[model samples]
Target chain A: MHNASTASTTEAATVPETTSSVDSYFADHPTPPFLDNYKDRIQDLLDFHASSPRPIVLITSGGTTVPLETQTVRFIDNFSAGTRGATSAEHFIAQGYVVIFLHRRFSLLPYSRHYSHSTHCFLDFMRPSEDGKNIQVVDEYRPEMLQVLTRYREAQSKRRLLLLDFVTVSEYLHCLRASALLLAPLGPRVMYYLAAAVSDFFIPTKEMAQHKIQSGDGSLSLTMTQVPKFLSILVHSWATSSYIVSFKLETDPKMLLPKAQQALARYGHQVVVANLLHTRKERVVLISPVASTEYTSNPQYSSHTIDLAPGTEEIEEPLVEELVHRHEDWQSTSSS
Target chain B: MHNASTASTTEAATVPETTSSVDSYFADHPTPPFLDNYKDRIQDLLDFHASSPRPIVLITSGGTTVPLETQTVRFIDNFSAGTRGATSAEHFIAQGYVVIFLHRRFSLLPYSRHYSHSTHCFLDFMRPSEDGKNIQVVDEYRPEMLQVLTRYREAQSKRRLLLLDFVTVSEYLHCLRASALLLAPLGPRVMYYLAAAVSDFFIPTKEMAQHKIQSGDGSLSLTMTQVPKFLSILVHSWATSSYIVSFKLETDPKMLLPKAQQALARYGHQVVVANLLHTRKERVVLISPVASTEYTSNPQYSSHTIDLAPGTEEIEEPLVEELVHRHEDWQSTSSS
Candidate 1:
């Protein structure tokens, strides 16, 4: 499935390097305050898992926002609920992997995803005693609730899962960079599952309005420059040994495979999990680089499709399982 | 309190009529499908409360998004967690008022606001028995949780609170218009508490991209037309006899009062609750029209400040009380 022309075309689209250099982008944007606090927390987490045989997975989830003003009244936001990342994190945890969840503030998390953002309140799950002295989960939900609660408690007690949060794209980049650099020492034991829907464009702070954009001005015109492509730098420079997986979400079905292949070729990442927006939960195509042999002519890359019956199965279960297997292969090959 | 000059200046900025007329805006934008379903629900709700003495208040909460494309991948979003609207809904319920909570989808709700969207998950507040047979709220949070549970249960049992949600500005406007028209029969007994942070600008459907906007085209420039000022029409036509209250939120402290006053003058709405972004949770100014008797000129309109000693009080409590008092006065005056 390696379409060279399409891949090269998409490379230009995905990596609009004319906007700003990677180094300048980092230098120009101020590091978020939370990075300093997360440094201590992430270090503590890594230290706790230092001697454990379990692989450590960093799952970045949700959507990053681009502020339009200095004192932001409004922002440009990507559309995502973090379902893929949250669901996948739970699978990784179940498979005996230590998890570091870096998510958008108030977006879904692994254990809490089931109840938090639903139309029905969490209180709806509770049933009061006849005497009104005690409360318990309703009969219908108790089984699943108890299971989730037990696993959550186990993870918390063992400190196998660490949580971090970000609001804006700047914060997300800073945190991601800091985390990747920290996780670099872990080498083959680390996996970077980047599922966050990072913004493609952003209004530079200097170009943004100091106050709210007033409506009296005939029409409001916003000029936003393309955000620097950090995936290339992340793969080549930061945590180069870690097995990295990035998602390519496309609304147009025709563009999905090509864009995924292009992202794989351009970024030189280990895997590109490609899915169409409408059927993302039901099916996904995992595209990765395939090694070439001297005697035979083989495809430069391979694509494997994972399909789940809608409503009957969670695709993340199979997706994570496949990735874990591939990660193991990657680890063994890298070590040799 | 009502500075005429400032009010006029704000009127020009607030209602940018140069973009489109109210009639044209409605004609151009397609109606949201939920409006038809909500019409029946609203009628049923009104029928249920036909004989009740409790006042009915429609509270619009949270922020609306402006989609960038027809099949939206990205959107411009306002900054709001629905704190004011959710907090005020609880107060209105406590004050013997029938509540209709119209809010942003997945934003905070009244009782759920306390636990949902917190840094800690709701599971953290629960404890499972040693044998893992039973689960209950932890000792520290039981009191408040029990109180909130009781009130929520009562509201559910009585059908005193109704919930409706919208994500985009188009959906919000369509729903708001339909609800206002349906509630007009209630006359002076009805109140409109509009606390939602709506987008001032929107890229019209005709102008929006059909698919996701590509980033390869150097810098992206967005030209957005002003959203029509519907408040004026809502007050004068849709729900003429209802006591209308709108919010004016500004990042600039100096622009806050003037904009609030201008909104009041331009819309001829009953009240304008003005607050600055940083100090909003602690203090707000309520501005309203004063009767001009032939005898004396009482400054045209009056402004009353509501301040909560931070961390000690919920501003919504006193703010709701003051609004309730003013609503009672409005009803009496209208009838007389």
Candidate 2:
């Protein structure tokens, strides 16, 4: 396996020096339209954190798009459904941490994630009351709805969860940098959970088409540059002392662990959760500098999976619990 | 603007002759995994239609993804949210037609479209009862929910709507051809609404990477060939007598009408709905062989927009009504 650091360095040397720095990247790309509102929302979260002693965790979820044109009729996209990040946020909230969920717009969200993305139509969950004048949750779904509702209401009432969203890679990166810098003062009390499927390559703004590319020219050929490695910047400068957990998703099982280990060695982050495309929901491996452990939904390892009612499985429940325990241990050791 | 027909012909000549035929393209590409299930679904829909004199309209929605690799960690996508197709399906059912909705998985659905893809959380529409034992739709949204619920229940109980979905461009095209051939016997009684934003170019299966393309290779360069044009075959062979309505969405307003008209002349389809990327929800022009007419959401043309209470607007309401009228006219004229 290639060392990620060496690979990135070699690639960077070939590209213009101006494109290597994060600052230069932002200077070249147009600022996202909602930057002001994003900053204001971050401020609101910080204010809420100031009034409480709870640790704040920022969870970035979903896939980011790299537009092929300025007008963006076509783009490159990843295959993320945002299931891992959104599910993890709810678990973090349950562990009494304040969550700032920065997700892809219209992907998924905490609490609502249970039903919104299901194949069963939302209308199927509702039934008319006996008189047909009112609509109510079906009896079978009421208990689950109530559980999610109570948690959601508790979080809302306490102002513990702040939801923010982005659509494209540029918007995501800008918001990530701004949020990290804004929360820098919190030091170890802040945690960064980067689960988003960020684009590895992008067409630079200077070379992208001004409008939609017409197919009348016969074949379409595109050359995209590697996106600057931002994880190193996030760990070393943006939120230097924060607990950072990043994800490595791969289709090839053999590449999973090696790539994840390379990410840890390269960026010096706290944790790297590795998963395969086909078996992700059923299995995952958590790799840290000190240890590597596997979690699975197999019946034999029921304890490693969520302890829901028999026949019901949710791997995220156990995954989040494990992370929370690790984060707590890290907090105590570092403070001492 | 270049004529679409001439451009397609010119492009076709440059490519190997085998690449221009639909049959050859399918032979080169792997059949989508869901082909069997897709055929079964179409059979069910055909059985449903056999018993009813009601005309059937097949609505294809959302964007089809063109995969960059056979394993597919990443893909190229278009900017369609499937709102147009979902909204039109509901309107078609209201017009007393049996509807077949072939959509991108998790994009949107007819009744569920009202809430599923919205920025507002689904939980936002629910409130705990005074007793805290049950949940009900909030009073503010009850009237709307009731209206949608009634219609949804009516469609379900009457078995008037069948929902099928696809994700990749290959699956979409395969399903489309299968559904069209199955419905060919219905002739003018069937309508084909092709609204899915299909990729114009795709990397041939033979050339696509079997594993994720490593970014360590530095800049990524790709060459994609123009997708074979299937509309002409759909018009001439697949479902020749069906009322075919295709969509032309361009970011450039200047090219909209001419491209749409060219499509009509080349494929001999009945209608081509021309829309600009930015104003598609608010305005669209219906271009037929003889004339082109615009439809807008402006209250002055309320009859052309869904007549909700004074402030609310939905362009699909009027758009579907106009199409239903046109279909009815064509039905009568052809039957005579």
Candidate 3:
């Protein structure tokens, strides 16, 4: 909506599936999209997605690394499983949608000559498990991942394992802001599953010890600042016209709805998910605050309330089935 | 559950909260429980959190720095609003649970200490408006967070902006592996929101990046190795006794269930959240995979079958709520 140019009207007519990323495949010249200056390619892709009806799914995972002074000062590394993004991507790939699985930090996904993933996983001479179970588990990798690797082995592609890591919050912010641009093309119907533990603030290096954490010293002080909310950026800028969904994982007092409401209000996402801390089981809640307050009375065994709006052609039924029938019987105003 | 001590009793009972950290938090002290060394004056707060019924909420809010080599590293970061942890903590606090809202990267939150966040109406950040009617909405923040920050500020609590940025895959992994111990005592209600963008794979230091971007080679290489699925650790280890929830963000693929199933299988979490990317609206599917193949079929809707088991006595209801209904349902259930 905030484009510098109208772009070619034909872009709406172009649904280039199996297309290239910001950088198209050159076969011989495998360059990152940023280098190829494939802005048009992405711009075209954005227009294409905007003009299309297909739902867009963007997957962002892993940590970001930055270039700093003093031998490249790095901070804030994490122990992420990469499972959130990897498995999610596989799911997206299977769900009949074009997936831009952007992985960060230590991911085990295969690379293509077209995409150079910074290798984030590594081997540690980890201390043997208290009982040795860790060794047993860590000794072997996952099967699905292994299969993906094998597929890559036979696939005719060359990949460089780009192991990009970041310690400073700024570096992660930069990478997130830039790479997040990838999601621009896919307008609306955008659902973001925010499953990452993002930092809220960064401390000053002078207060933090190079090694050793001081307990209750307050001496190790940090000047805290708010990081840019990527979800907000997407809604307010990148995909401002697009529908966005985000997450809120919490615990302690366990206030789910208030947080959900806050999320909906602060980030402009249509839905906000709030889950309790240590909720290893399936008790996560999906709050659709935008739904009419009337949902409180819309009784159905349905665990959630789905708001069906007019105009948009909804398939035979909502994607999620109603656990219980709604009390209201409506005449079908034929829009389809 | 293999144990270093063949004595499962000892291993289970005395499970060190953080013995396996590759990046030791107490490296300076070199003691297992550093709290004990300080003349026992520290009150064993960390231990209390481990045993606290309130369940420990460990939030990692900063980005990680990835290293190019052992000595040189780049600061890779993402743009994120620490809102996820900060606000979520407010919700949890209002829910009447003790929360350990750990943060990094950003520094400030707007609220008074001890404020009951749920007592106020929060602003709707997710909605869009052309006339800026929505923009006029008063921004809402939870009160508990305000209260805590106020206390911390007034107490002059010895604090540091704890931003955990990682620049290399290994560094991220190291930090991640280290912090996992924190969850040991708190056990199962652990909800790891992988909202961070970690690099999927990286270029192996060896024979990769020879033609750096500065040279305009525009070519980078990597021997991408999959990062270990740390999320699975939650499943295999404690969730064997606790619960795990994960999130999946999608783009282009509207069909979101299968990927959720894949996440369930791989991570063994009770719930796998699937959402679309780049939309202003929030849309996600909460999938709870029934571990058992035999499901009770009503033939009306796709049934969500779950194997119910209790992790701890105090968690029975919380566990059930996570297993089936929403968190609000739990409140209703508990109150009713």
Candidate 4:
């Protein structure tokens, strides 16, 4: 299954003219073979997009990590049990999209199996803890997630697919890198939402001694280093890249705009979300920088995207609408 | 603890303005404690009225079933997960109201425990199948829920209090009658959102055997009968002596307004919300008659209160602003 890890894109790929100018951006994107057995996944997504006069979006969730050390890695951890990320995924699906949820272990996302762009089956690992045991867990696998993936599995029955599990930051990075390469052939319309709480820094941990640290905390004092940024990895790793968006949380409100603009400038991302630890439940602000194009046939790039003021209210809708529309326009222009 | 169950009014004893107006209407009410917890209740309620700068609304949630055979019986159960009720409670709390949430068992509310007004902790019950020995159960007796109810419990600490758990509907009704009496002295500002789906029709299964019914070729009879309606009970019960609001869910949109008006007319309630179930959500239209009057040198009833068409986009802020303005008018009248 990993043999076609980085499949070559067709030199003369057909662009369907009947599809809207926005959809043409995702011209290279594979629709992941349609099958009759899966009841929920494809039909809902196709019907919603074909019916509604709005652009659809997919938001990937869970925790992404970076490797900083060889002996032991420095990880950026959050208190999030995946409630906010999971809720956002639900809202996006409700808004109608072929949601490609690259969720982490124990995400507890609703209808995960029948909710992906690619109907791929993956295994998630879990170790028992007291708090973990107490959470309102649905022990049984969700029907929708299981059913769709199994259908896809039979279609590609010839090759055996691999299922890998991770414990440390290095392992997560390796998995993400491998997955990104496989998804590189996807068209530009793919809007990448980096909502995961990725550790910005990591430290080298000894592979043999790493298992020992799980049982007991060693006198592990070490140096830390910044890992390759996800947004950078996202853009540079692919040729026909998706619209990347990253989050920036800071203490100062005034610094939010500059930091967001910096992220956009540094990574060439479409949107940057900034939030304080205090506003975790309530208010959040997102700044979307739409780059204006001159002498372009596509009239959309004629205007620039504006950064809306921050409020606790549902800003996600307006933000997505503006960003996706821009993405659609940008895709058509770049492809043409 | 059951003694706390009584009427929440002192109008019968008080020789206030319009004793005759209500006296002529309700002749046969549930016995004295007719206005349960009336004296101290009324005083504390008056304090809340004087202090609160906004509309004070109390929203009740969950189901209430009528008994058929044994005094503690439930006939039919509707698929109510308490979404509407719990969501409504959060909206009320958001609007800055001094909210008093009368919730039932197993509600999926978010800020219920965090909110100051959430009622006492109710036990959630689950029974295993015939083959299974152990049962699975989860209850929300969070430290926060206990903290909110500590004051109420302390006041009645000197006296004996018994906590009753209800699985069948009749026990729920019995518990509510007493609970409403404790909340009765709250007066006109009280806005009860009766979102619970009390069984309309029930089979005579209250006294059925605990053992599972085996499949048989023999004739099985289900004598279905109209269970006592909670709506009618509220309209007729002494609980409606204070300002009350009821909900009406109908299949037909055309029937909504007429039924809502009928509910307002029958119950003498301030508001009757008529909703059409479009999928899992309700599209509501309110019918509020018998508006409350602010005390003045010449006490005059204000027929105009905040009435607006419900919009799916956003209504939280608008509702708060409208309710607050109306409350200010009430305060102005009271001060003068």
User: Evaluated with lDDT, which candidate comes out highest?
Assistant: 1
lDDT (Cα, tens digit) per residue for candidate 1, span A46-103: 8887788789999999999999989989999999999998989889999989999999
Residue A210 shift from truth in candidate 1, angstroms = 1.2
Which ranges of candidate 3 are over 4 A from the true structure?
A1-336, B1-44, B48-52, B60-65, B68-82, B100-104, B107-172, B188-195, B203-213, B216-218, B238-240, B279-281, B291-336
Q: Per-residue lDDT of B1-336 in model 4, one digit per residue for the tens? A: 001012113121112224342332233122234234433443455464565544455455555433322322112234344566655555555555555444444343423323312221111212222344322222343333333334323322322111122334444454455555555554444445566655444334443432222112222233444444444444345354344556666544566666666544433444565565552252345555433321112212222223334665333334434444544554454345
Per-residue lDDT of A1-336 in model 4, one digit per residue for the tens? 011112122121112122242133123222323212222333334344454434333344555432222222122232233444555544454443445444444433433322221111111111122453322212353333334333333322311111122333444444444455544545464556666655444433332233112201312332344444545545544423556666665545566566666565544445676664445445455664433411122212122333434764444555555555656776676467
**Shift in Å, residue B296, candidate 4:** 25
**Better model by TM-score: candidate 2 vs candidate 3:** 2
Stretches of model 1 off by over 4 angstroms after superposition: A1-20, A293-299, B1-20, B293-299
Q: Compute the lDDT of residue A209 as modeled in candidate 3.
A: 40
Candidate 3 local distance difference test against the native = 0.36
TM-score of each: 0.93, 0.89, 0.34, 0.34
How many steric clashes between backbone atoms does each model show? 0, 0, 193, 22
* Model 3 chain A: worst 10 consecutive residues (lDDT sum): A323-332
Candidates arranged by DockQ, highest first? 1, 2, 3, 4
Q: List lDDT for all candidates, in order.
A: 0.83, 0.79, 0.36, 0.40
Q: For candidate 2, lDDT tens digit of each residue in B1-336?
A: 111222224322122224347887788776777778878877887786687789899999999999998888899998888999999998899999998899988888898888877778888888788898988788999999999998998998888888888888888888898888889889889998998898899999889998888788779999999888878777666776788889999998888877876676556567788888988878877876542211111101011222333554777888888889988888887687
Give DockQ for candidates 1 onward, in order: 0.72, 0.67, 0.01, 0.01
Which docking class does model 1 fall in?
medium
Query: Which candidate should be chosen as best, given DockQ against the real structure?
Result: 1
Which candidate number maximizes TM-score? 1
What residue runs in model 2 are displaced by over 4 Å at the alpha carbon?
A1-20, A291-312, B1-20, B291-312
Model 1, B200-286: lDDT tens digits are 899988999988888768789999998888776676568777888999989998888778776765666678999988999899999
Regarding DockQ, does 3 or 4 come out ahead?
3
CA displacement after TM-score superposition, residue A297 of candidate 2 (Å):
37
Off by over 4 Å in 4: A1-336, B1-56, B63-75, B112-167, B203-210, B218-220, B232-237, B279-282, B290-336
